[model samples]
Target: MDYFIIVITSAAGLYFHWWLYVRIKRWMDRDLALSLAGADADKRALMLQRLGEAQASGIKRGDLPAWLARAAGEYAPPRD
Candidate 1:
């Protein structure tokens, strides 16, 4: 009985953790989408270019522009 209780508790904890993670991830994704939606096409392109350059040159996050810094925290790149 004790073993069964422990198993159930472990499963419940795992499920709760997974649910929380998914909810948070979805919220973040939505927030990023909204942020990027407010930007013009030119700004979006520039931001993407900046991210690419940063990745290529191994630039740190602190070196990014303010807009990008904000966007990076929420938004993901569009699908190619």
Candidate 2:
């Protein structure tokens, strides 16, 4: 009886862990897609234009947050 209980509990725990992992993976994929989409041409152009104006107004690169810097670095121009 005890052995059966342990086996059942272990199976349940593994299933729960797998379920959580799948859910987290799906959420991460969705967020990554959204991030990449935001780096598309229209979005990048808008951001670059804004940044240019900001720079002209004396908003230095060092003043921007690390996340913005990372995003700008990772952003790729959309391909045809």
Candidate 3:
């Protein structure tokens, strides 16, 4: 019975963390998208730099915080 309770609590904690991560990711995506889409060149540049850093960290473009599935027109292939 003790083991069962421990298992249940562990599972609940893991689920909570996963749920929090998803919510934060969604918020980040929304903010990043807005920043990139704005007319302010400075803000756009900043966001682009952030995107570059994320790429350097081995994160895919599709996984970037500002990634938009339906908005592919903005991204360009990286120059080597």
Candidate 4:
């Protein structure tokens, strides 16, 4: 039916959109992580240490990204 075709097309569109979004997100995150990790040795060590502390303190795997983001924000320099 025509309606079935429309529904299938819409679903495919949504799936492709989501797939693209995830791909772009992953690439951007990798770029940002490399930039931050390569910026300063002391800061990088501190970030790793703090992340270890967080893991030791029982932060779950699913929550680590948000936790790391918050920790990074704390250490990030203020922008003008």
lDDT scores for all predictions? 0.62, 0.59, 0.63, 0.70
Q: Candidate 2, residues 1-80: lDDT per residue as tens digits?
A: 99999999999999999999989955653444345447465755645554555446765445534434555566566678
Q: Report model 2's TM-score to 2 decimal places.
A: 0.46
Tens digits of lDDT, candidate 3, 1-80: 99999999999999999999989975675577556557756555556565555646776646674353223345554556
Q: Which pairs of residues have clashing backbones in candidate 4? A: none
Question: Candidate 3: lDDT of 77?
Answer: 42
- Report the alpha-carbon TM-score of model 3 versus the true structure: 0.48
**Per-prediction CA RMSD (Å):** 8.0, 11.8, 9.7, 8.4
**Candidate 3 clashing pairs, residues 3+ apart or interchain:** none
lDDT of 1 by residue, 29-72 (tens): 44543465456665556556655655577654444445456655
Candidate 1 global TM-score: 0.47
What number of clashing residue pairs does each candidate have, in the order they appear?
Answer: 0, 0, 0, 0
Question: Which scores better on TM-score, 1 or 3?
Answer: 3
lDDT of residue 60 for candidate 1: 49
Query: How many Å off is the CA of 56 in candidate 1?
Result: 28
TM-score of each: 0.47, 0.46, 0.48, 0.48
